[model samples]
Target: MKMRLEVLLVVTAVMCAAGKPLSKAAARNKLLLISFDGFRWDYDQDVDTPNLDQLAVDGVKAKYITPPMLTMTSPSHFTTITGRWVEDHEVVHNMMFNTSTNLKLPHKLTLTKSQWWDNGVLPLWITAQNQGLKTASFYFPGGAANYSGQVVNRVMVEPFNHPNANETEWRQNIDMVMRWFSEEDFHLVTLYYGEPDNVGHTKGPDHPDRKTIIQQIDRTIGYLRKAIDQHNLADSLNVIISSDHGMTTIKKRPLVDEIILNKYLNLLKLASFEILDYGGFGILTPQPGKEQEVFDALSNAPNLTVYKKNEIPESFHLAKSERLPPIVVVGDLGFNLNSRFIVYVNKGDHGFHNGEMDMKTIFRAFGPDFRRNFLSEPFDSIHIYPLMCKLLQIEPAPHNGSLTVTEEMLQLHSGGSQRAPVSVALPLLMLLTFSAL
Candidate 1:
């Protein structure tokens, strides 16, 4: 009798803890994931962001999110979507380069290169579509690639030298996304905005023009919310606004310290291929038999931390990929590693170590599914993938995200604070049996 009673109590607790099964209506909820590139965690601290503040009042806002290492545009964005570290996804740099041929393609051209993005792991768009849900991506990195013969149902890649600051085009893009939700009935849509990041790169993060871009982003958010209501689909839509990484003012030459790699090491003789003149990160493929020779030369260089592929700190989670060369270089915050000369031409840059405060970015969510007026503490951006899968009511691919890290932000009826019933039940049943014996 005692054993039976204990088992009964355990079953009751398990069922109660799992909560009610998600309702069909709840499962039908749609999701919109938006990325505003380079939107810092504190971008709105100085500027008045009425719409964004209103969003915080309506739903949820995280204090900040730490992106994966090498906080450049493509790698960080891919990490958010795939919940994988930079090395896992293997989209290690904005520019696509071949280590053997010494061929390189700029960021824009790299977008159309399927071979560059179609690695073994699947991004969320392909994962969602595989689970019988329709998905689309607009100007989002990794969106246009054919992931092992599967492709997103809808995609809009940015054209060459596309103007990033056109307000009208931004609005039009929003309008089109609304159509994807309402007319085409997409279950998930990811939209990208190239903003203050563009302005920050050219004029610096602290420049007055960056404030203007923030205002534009604020206005666009207002437009997005009003459009959601106008479409009469507000109750069925869940929206999350976030960014890839933050920006920092680059320490230019003749003023502060810089990492001119060629000045410290002989690239021509020591390296077979080198990726430099980018931002605060670089990669080197040493000439055969010269691995230790190259590492010794760069290890003591100022304003840079050099690591052999195997010696890269475990905190970075960057040593697992074949795409990575033998030696890796990370410039200190506010510095860019240069190859031949200091020719970055930009006043601000990213791609610093992920732990830097300047590399943290923004996260906001609103809709019927989220908690009202909730402010969450900082969390890693990799957890976003599981949160999105929960919102779409689909099984997620194998990912690094944990739903527990983000599930608290969801409303009770929207699958918050619930574990799979069987997962919770098994342990309790075993405990009861052992105690009875």
Candidate 2:
């Protein structure tokens, strides 16, 4: 009788545990985050972006989302997904330190499967994989096959170039994403379009051709939206449009004379200083005891803000990392960092901080689950990751910012009643000991 009673009790407990309700929200919707690189907010007025405008009317639009430091591709993209500054994530730029000594590091450091690890942070794809949700990326900068292994279900490598040469390649990227949406089950997807950014880099943000490219991208979004609706997937689909950074037009290209730089180099008794080619500038490490003299000379130069690595602005969040060079140089807006070997003929550059507004990018979210005809207080792009987790009904990882999903947006709210508290199960030994004594 005793053994039979025990068996019955075990069965009852198992049923109770199995029947327990989860504390998470129901993840019934799919998420798509699309990055239109170098897209400026003003472009909306310049071009007829009906789909994006519709998203704004049917969802929430945040007027500004400031890009994280260097305001470049690699770091800004990482910031959007990681919800942390590049200094914390350790992917400060497209090219980073390879460490003087070769030794295995954290999984995050392994930038590529083949190379030794370079970064030290996990991106959102890894987080989604941990939760057993399917994630996909279409030609995102950081989602290259070399870096995204088992973390992402599909990754397409499509480089940015003129549409004339890369139109077929670009179309292939769109076709692959559409096919995946039609065939596979994905919880999260990220798509990247690089034409506007490429054109802005070569021509300028205000270039007439940029408007044409914006229209092309808008048409692509229209096609995707139409496909979803035609397949009756609108209720379960969500779309987010954002950008890496904004672009500024340049009118003057500065020249750095080799003779002047060499004079300083000889006086400093440096073995050799590597001058970066093109308008992009870099200074190789100087011999010991000459670092200060080299920095002082650059500091006195016109149209430059020279800062020691530690003195980089707190707003930029670049002070904490060792990946930064000992001395950092920033050029004024509309100016490029030039070296003796090369000159910049055109006027357009990013990656340098002019001010907060100049570095701001666009953020828009639209879907059945989002709040419609609303706008939230401008927040950092880092908030997007946590917000995504919330929308997907996953336990949010600790983040530096709060995600505000207002009740009006969702059209639901608790009527001043406290939700029931939930208790997690204790280990068997602890439960047994605490049961009676």
Candidate 3:
């Protein structure tokens, strides 16, 4: 009896070892999450985008997804991947500012500061790595930071002053991501491009130059899909093309029309620190005893809405963080909240209230798992995190998204079956092993 039991145990071990390879093969499809920074939802509408049109025909396209409030780059991008509101993730702005020291870091320098990004929430890259899947982030916002001392399997931070309009460099990035998926076995990779956003800021969103950049981006999409085919990832890899937020033409003419804060309140006397002149958003810490006075002054400012931090509306999701100031100010659409009148160069800007139509962004998904030719109704950008988690077959950390919101975008296989459950497969495999022995 001992000899027979030993032989049966050996057979079971062999069967289990053989079955693992098959189980892993069937586990989940690889994901490529690409963010074209500042690519507006309707950008392709005016440009000749054969590739983008093809992508929409081949997979699912959202009407236009609403990004989280305070539609700045760092805040919006973090929300896209982590599925948390800007206040919830604590990456409340592109520039990291400390109210105590009045210290501020520019967007580039802030990219490397782990403390600015690692605050408790786990981004998709780190979460995937912890679950034994290889992941990478190539120039994606919040990609370079270490989350709780854990980093992505591979990371490439965009160098300072990196040219966003270099077409060749964009192709090279696509090739590298292909290698990450095909050669290095990366299960998920987040790639970013600083294109149309840069152009939109320099030239107005309606300018012909911005349209040209959109054309360039469309061509890059063609190159990306071709590279996927060349690398033999066409069948297995899932691709999501998306952006952080849309751009709007900045209202620069008629200086009187600008929302100048100094014109309304005495900043020096009433505020100890302030983050003003940042698009449509402003936050300030009141002087020790000037809280009510400061609030009343800005409350009556024209074209600007003032809110006490706790009194901020629930819809904006801008409250409930220590990083937030006691007083919050927002300008009307296309209006810049200026501290003083200066030569405002950028013809375009974002960081407005998300409810503005100009603040909505794009989302596209294509792969073996996604349904074909589906035009999905607009959904919140936060819902994307759960969709990605479901695609990777991984348990998502406590996120604010619900899979039910995005599950319909996926394809249901024959007999309504999608992936085979491991529990069912393992038992059947064990029975086969026992029968063979």
**TM-score versus the correct structure, for each prediction:** 0.90, 0.77, 0.89
The alpha-carbon deviation from the true structure for residue 387 of candidate 2, after best TM-score superposition, in angstroms, is 1.1
Model 2 earns a TM-score of 0.77
CA displacement after TM-score superposition, residue 433 of candidate 2 (Å): 38
Per residue, candidate 1 scores C-alpha lDDT tens digits across 310-381 of 988888888897898888888899988898777788899898898999999999999978889999999999
* Pairs of colliding residues, candidate 2: 109-117, 109-118, 110-117, 250-347, 371-409
Model 2's lDDT to the true fold? Answer: 0.63
Judge candidate 2 at residue 240 and give its lDDT.
Answer: 79
Q: Residue-wise lDDT of candidate 2 within 23-117, one digit each (tens)? A: 13444677888898877656677788897787677887887777776677767887887777877876665554443431223322333433322
Residue 322, model 1: lDDT of 84
**Steric overlap count per candidate:** 0, 5, 0
Candidate 1 vs candidate 3: which has greater lDDT?
Answer: 1
Error of 2 at 193 (Å): 1.1
Computed on alpha carbons, the lDDT of every model, listed in order, comes to 0.88, 0.63, 0.85
Model 3: clashing residue pairs? none
Ranking 1 against 2 by TM-score, winner: 1
Candidate 1 residue spans exceeding 4 A from truth: 1-20, 23-27, 413-437
Clash pairs, candidate 1, are none
lDDT of 2 at 294: 67
